[model samples]
Target: MGGSSLRRLNARLVTVGVLLVLAWGGIGYRLVVVQALEADVYADHGLDQRLQREILAADRGTIFDRDGRELAVTVDSVTFYANPSEIEDPTTVARLLAPLLHQNMLDVLDAISGEGTFAYVARQLERDDADRVIAARLPGIYYFTEPKRVYPMGELTGHVIGFVQADDNQGLEGLEYQYDDSLSGVPGELLVERDPHGRTIPQGEYQVVPAEPGSDLVLTIKTEIQFAAAEALQRAIDRTGAKGGSIVVVDPATGEILAMVNLPTFDPNDRSDADPAAFRNRAVTDVFEPGSTQKVITISAALEAGIADPDTIFEIPTTIERGETVFRDSTTHPSELTVTGIVAHSSNLGTITLGEMLGAKELHRNLYAFGLGQPSGVDFPGEASGLLRPSEEWCAVNCVASTSIGYGVSVTTLQMAMVYATVANDGVWVQPHLVKEIVDGKGTRVAVEPLQRRVIDAATALSMRLMLEEVVSGGTGGYAAVAGYRVGGKTGTTEKYLIDEQRYSEDDVVASFIGMGPIDEPRVVVAVVLDSPRQDDSGGKGAAPVFAEVALAALHQLGVPPDDR
Candidate 1:
């Protein structure tokens, strides 16, 4: 009986021992599958929870004038961010951040309570305000340094500097948009680990790829000259009760633009309340019939082709009849005038006669060589290649007559200025340019060379300067004479064509003056253009005065010795 009972108990014990051994073997097999076969997959999954990859912004470059004055620059700013998941008491956090960020408390609260893990509370905060926020040390709130584009001179160079979009910091207009690639820097990367509490792990795995800052731009603009031109243009607009105006001052020798200004310009820094119309850089963007200014080109062509000289005499009737069209001067002059006298008086009759002699092909070729009907290659955005019909298209007799008087053809103020600049540069046409050099973060500098070509002989250019001097000294552009200096210039007034009426408007005229100084050795070429001035104010009375004011100031600023003195 005892043996039977013992045997039953032993069998039960053996069954329990066998079951335990099987269970242990199954657990060991599972450990090998997880630890060895799937080790890499589990390791990556764990790292995903602890490691964070972030984009680091690179600082944008600075823009400076030729004199090293900062025009556009980058400054450090604070960007406020929040982790919505960790933001407890969103109402309290929003209330504290509202005054510091200049934001609505309700909006801030909504942002912090969003379903997303991260949200922007405020972007580009002022340093003082950011400091205050940092002192507050609100949970789930964080900040990082960001680069903000700032225009220190405000509207002084707004047209050329242009502005950027706040949302993505992308350039939208002007030089900013045209040179975006050089101005925008290469971004970097940041890799770091975090703990369970969402804090950076101390002495843990971290990596960084440093950002490469953008290259700096050096412009050919002279800030002082720019200011003077802007002031003079504004005064002219105010005096004439004109809609708007533009002025361009250039160094004839190198074709470096000293100043380019347009009235009704907007401040690049704060464009939220600016008018869209003010954003246009009229000097390069707007086109108008050059009026009497075109006569300079015609006279230049005639002089260069051996057809005439300063003393070449021609009978200038009061009115010229070409087919059915009648062309008359601003004033009646029935006497004979020399080539110099014709340009000085800005006679439409004489100019049209010269155009007939030159014919359309030769005239068009001369105009093209002078940079008309082409972009100035100014490194600016939205430059207009003014309206110019090919010689073949000038079959109509009216086309030749109208173009001779600057009626049918159109040109930008920059092109007109460059034309005079070529004459001042002894007939060598230098391409107008804005940028002077490019400098990288490592202090490497690369210079920009402007394009150049010969438009006329040096002797012809000298003769043109002498004839232009006659204009300022005694002719229609007398008001353009500067004190203590010998001035050379031409006055222009043209009626604007009405798009709706399909004819030229009698009241709407563009008044302009193109000039150079010290006829012996010209230093600067300036062009002033005003739109829709009072009918009583012709180019001689309106634009010439502005030209004198700006040209005088420019001469003084450039330290040019007065020729009169």
Candidate 2:
């Protein structure tokens, strides 16, 4: 009986062992089928459920002035990102990143544990903060490089260099916006593979198409001249207690703008906190009612039309009758004034009488020919084409007479400078340029060419120059005279615009002066306009001094020998 029972027990043990071996073999076959036969399908499914792809931004271009000074540039910065799936301790990660990123712990936790596999913890982190984040080494938290634009010069050329947005590299104002496409280069791409632990595999096959940096832009502005002009105008505005001011200096021969400055300028580096009005490049944008400064154009037109001679004598009077309005002389001279004396003295009565000979139609035509009432085509944004009503819109003989003295029409400071430059350059109207050239990423240069046109005959320009020289030699713009330099210009003080279209307020007036140096062979033309100065200030007192200061600065820098020397 014992032998039979032992044999049965041995048989039962053998049966159990065989059944266990068969079951194990079947499970192994199923595993081989799932892992080896359908490997690619399972891998794709896993990637689709947890993997994501994003863009890595490219660096922007560098902006330099004519002197190779850095105006705008892109710098390397760190940005923090998170992967919620791999965070071991959400509270610990939040606390670690909060102080470094200057973000609340709750906000960091929300970003880390959000629905997406990837989320931004902080962008544009400072160097110190980036180092702290890297030191923390919190799971699922990391940083990569990005770009930001840096403006070195504060408000010196803020209007010229312009500004860009902080988040996206897009130009917001001025030349930056005008030349944005050339500055913001094409962005590149990067691909990464992450493991179950949310760590990027070091050796993962990454397809990185390196980005192309944007081409560098070289401006036509001379940095030194720009700084000087800006500083000078700022001083003038402060001293005169004027509302604002603008000045432009142009090379009369070549028409290249040497310096362009406007007061109340903003610091481009901190443009985010500056006033919006300070961003205006007023030299090219603001149009004002140019007073007696326009007599040069009228006299030139009259001479060009064979209407009057430089020696033509017009009997001077206290006032002149034109239909209903009476145009009077600012001075109390009661003697006869020659055409030269009329221009030299800036006699509104004498000049209007001379313009009366041209009539409204011819006067308006000449004004249009002088680049007023139209765009000067300077390479900047928001340029204004000053107002010059058509001859058909004139009310009476006085309307025509008023325009002859530079009252009815308006012009930008740049346009006025160009007008004087044209006269100085013998009537050839050259278009102004801000950007000189565009150098590609590979150092290939694409030059920006300028345009030139003829505004009047050379003979007419010469006659006008002589008359303007008299204006400064012994006339209204006497303060603008340079000791050794033969200077010629005109002074203009116009009543400020009445916003409510009511009676003129004695409080507001725009004082301006436009002049050129070394009248014999003019090198540069300067135009300065100061708005709403305090007290009873005229162009001779307020704007003429500024013109003289800036002109002397330009002369000193240009190394022109003074006439007195």
Backbone clash count, each prediction separately = 0, 4
219-253 per-residue lDDT for model 2 (tens digits): 76777777777877878877889988898988888
Candidate 2's C-alpha runs over 4 A off are 1-37, 44-58, 78-145, 192-204, 500-503, 561-565
Per-prediction TM-score, please? 0.89, 0.83
CA lDDT of each prediction against the hidden true structure: 0.89, 0.83
Q: How would you encode candidate 1's per-residue C-alpha lDDT over 180-294 as one tens digit per residue?
A: 8888889899899999997999887699998888889999999999999989988888899988889999999998999999998889988879999999999999899998998
For this target, which candidate reaches the highest TM-score against the unseen true structure?
1
For model 2, the run of ten residues with the poorest summed lDDT: 49-58
Residue 41 of model 1 has an lDDT of 85
Model 1 alpha-carbon drift over 4 Å, by segment: 1-30, 81-99, 102-121, 136-142, 190-209, 332-334
